[model samples]
Target chain A: MTWGIIGTWRMVHDGLVAASKMLQENKRVGDAIEECVKAVEDYPYYKSVGYGGLPNEEGILEMDAAFMDGDTFEIGGVAGIVDAKNPVSVARALSKQKFNSFRVGEGATKFARLAGFECGNMLTERARRTWELRLDEVKKNNLNPYDGHDTVGVIGLDLSGSMAVATSSSGLFMKKAGRVGDSPLSGSGFYVDSEIGGATATGLGEDLMKGCLSYEIVRLMGEGLSPQAAADKAVYGFHHKLRKRYGKAGAFSLICMNLKGEWGVATNVDFTFSVANESAAPAIYFAKMGQNDTTVIEPITEEWLAAYEKRIKQPIE
Target chain B: MTWGIIGTWRMVHDGLVAASKMLQENKRVGDAIEECVKAVEDYPYYKSVGYGGLPNEEGILEMDAAFMDGDTFEIGGVAGIVDAKNPVSVARALSKQKFNSFRVGEGATKFARLAGFECGNMLTERARRTWELRLDEVKKNNLNPYDGHDTVGVIGLDLSGSMAVATSSSGLFMKKAGRVGDSPLSGSGFYVDSEIGGATATGLGEDLMKGCLSYEIVRLMGEGLSPQAAADKAVYGFHHKLRKRYGKAGAFSLICMNLKGEWGVATNVDFTFSVANESAAPAIYFAKMGQNDTTVIEPITEEWLAAYEKRIKQPIE
Candidate 1:
């Protein structure tokens, strides 16, 4: 059997690595623990997810997150958490705490702080100032405040054949208050199944949520489709439905891993995500958006991924 | 007074040249009409507003178009017309005849055939036979029919202070029948006014219609915004909204001419559209999507305009 986990945000990744280490030592699943730990510590940029993300129009860093364990079908999520240093921790808490499945808004932020996270000061002073100035500019221009940039996610499969997926995002910068995108939404943002595969999404949360793209991707795999086909179908279906409603806007980037150790990736726009496989070094992939009609896929090198990882971990003094 | 016409299809350019000659001899508008007519006939592949465009999902070539005489807002349009040898004629008929607009569908095709244009049978023996072989290969791999592809369009203004715009597309190839895109929809697909400017859109039709992006661009021009600024705002608004709704699936390319005899162009993706002016020749500008986030602008060249004028006399075969 195999087990895995996925998440967005560096802090959350660290926490998951720590937790997985604890579980590995205690539960005696020894083979894949090193890779899982390494994946978390290897990749950095959480602008799309986690507390360090760029703030919205209000100069507040809000977060959305979810975690799922394929073996147990256990899921945990939190949305609209403000000043939470690591929103994924809340999702982890929910998954580990049993009774807590979800949380939202100020309460979730408070819980994270109480749980020993560094909260209430997630944004650096410079970011806050920039956010304030941009907010005013957006207001003057009559633009939406919440149109933030990206989302983050993590997924994994363990040695015992269990899988997990997690996601987080700051939502759109300058979005309306209390706006929840697909990040913390179950099924839409995160899905995991040890017998099939696991998938998570970032960008254009509402469209991903409305179409239930993540879950559908996993479900498609369960129906015996290849990982690539599942990813393509999921993205295509979401686009078709979205075209019927809002036209087009952001993008949806996804990573899925099947039971046999195969992986698939799909997206409508440029995206960045990382992965770690047994016996291989952790790596991140950056897909650049192209000008032509076709969507081309490319992988970022290990060197770039390592450099980015260092950048994310460097603390502001 | 100044008068000019803009067209997007390969043959429509020919028609515009014929019309320009007629108008100059009978009406006396000079360089503007000559340049406008020339711009249409020379551009080999204006995907959004021309013939032989990339087909929609059904592999059928459908067209959307509009023309505006800035002096009177005398406009004519036809959307989703398939099998017509020259959709521009139908659009001209709408302006010249009692009816003034038509939507894409079988009926539109019938009207074109009845009006003496050659209408090719859709998915007849040859097309079906080709599909049968291709479908079997795709089905063997369990792939869905609808995927992703590009669409096309055209817009222009003349020296006589009159403006006209037109557009066409084959819709998405292998698409479900009865799907109408923004091409045929007024305001969404194309808009023109000598007092303000003229604009036309291509890409995701649904988003263009929902946002009324073409009209928005023109209105921005009316508000005294530079054509570039107006186009940027309109495209940005539509892009943001669409991302919020469905992720990013569509884009728009536009050309605008202000009353001051200045021209503007904008787009959200990598695409191209050409313009001809009294002082210069018709020149084609290519915009590469995602390479530069900001829009690019340049003045038309005199030599290009001269060459453009030379190509406008004959009917498009």
Candidate 2:
């Protein structure tokens, strides 16, 4: 039996390690994704998601998340939801319904409450201080406030051959209130078909939504391209086309895993991800755009990991 | 110069005819979409869009709308926004921004107010009575509460050879508060590229979001397929596969117009649409699913138009 899991960013590594064990034991795809994403959401130091995620311009902490069951094509999502400790868990619960699966703002927060999911203030003291400092800097220096848009996107394939995908983010740091990124959007943010494969994205939500790259990659995989080839073709091709047509393209990253337990990744900027499968242990890798529409991927280095750990935990002042 | 415009449902017929005149005049794609969509929003007799539209289970007139610029690939959308007299215009304004193009709920409503676009309560007296009756019937008979989810989706190609797409809807009748549908989603409800073509959809947003059929149709057009072939292949193929995978496929209809002004349509259930182009005047057509995944289309009969006009304005008890 072959089981696999892949997620964007270094933050998801520990969660994937736990979910990886569940997959090996033949747990279903739905639970595997929720457990993995919830771990990222609950962590207090990941500044782009859940507990410690940065706030919008108004200093309010809103979040976006989505869950999709590749087997049944059931999709549920929430955007601009607040005070939900684990937005991914709320998304998973909503996926069971036939209608009203995607909710936003007050509705999404209320669902978390009415359904008896865990709820608490997500804003951390460090996060608020960081937002205040950034707000002051941006105004003083006339700096761009759009930053820290990473979303924890996970793709899981179980021993039963079922696959599922989920994504969660606090959206662009200092974004306008109620802004929704591609993290909660289908096709752009995530797409999976258990019979074919699954793909998820993290990056500039605005530009990512312009090209439904996740859906395109899965479609390419279904047409017989390997996951690597599909990621290369879909991601690089659209990145080039978008620059030509739209005059500029924003940074974005994508990862995919096919039904055979093979996986692939591509990006226009530096990206890190963790993955594990039947043949490999959970490991983190860093990738960057390479020459000729390719991606250069390597094992995460000790120096980079150590630096990241130090930076996230640095003093707020 | 060649020009074209197509929109979902007979409800858009009058609006399309008015916009057809502007398309021939070489107006920009942005204003053309807003003008057409706003007409539908203002017509109080229409019960599924803008003013006079059906409300959610809570009897709130929440609305969803989106606008996309094909040349630059800018997208703006709003979901669960309340009391906006013309959500399409607000979406158009948001598309010009580089960040925070999509907003939801209270934030969306606030954006409309802050931007100084028109605002008013959207629920009509007749719509409120209909909601009351439906609520009573569902409680007494235990019938399905989901119905009347048609969205006004428009695709416009102007004399300048530019294309754009827009959509507006009140979402599913009696949906849970803050429920969102495909109308505001990028690849599901609508997609456009001035270099290739544009497509928009109507019917069940829940089923529609699962397929990303709008992007598929446009991509097929990019591959040199005629609009008719693209629509037929993308819509019918997904419809067939979805039923096999998910056990049932909801009703859906799609309409497309290529850059050259050629157009096509496909659907899984009975549908109606209005189209105009360099070669054809604005006219409504009826379509139905035919044998072997083809769509059978015929000009709308005068009797059918008369019946529709009467049905929409009929009194609600």
Best by TM-score: 2
**Residue A2 error, candidate 2, Å:** 1.1
Off by over 4 Å in 1: A1-46, A97-100, A113-118, A139-146, A288-295, A301-317, B1-317
Candidate 2: segments with Cα more than 4 A from true spot: none
lDDT of 2 by residue, A198-281 (tens): 999999999999999999999999999999899999999999989998888999999999998899999999999999999999
- Candidate 1's displacement at residue B68, Å, is 39
Give one digit per residue, the lDDT tens place, for model 1 in A42-94.
23344444544666545666667666666655555666677765566666666
In model 2, the number of clashes is: 0
Query: What would the TM-scores of all predictions be?
Result: 0.43, 0.99
- The DockQ figures for the candidates are 0.01, 0.84
RMSD from true fold, candidate 1 = 21.4
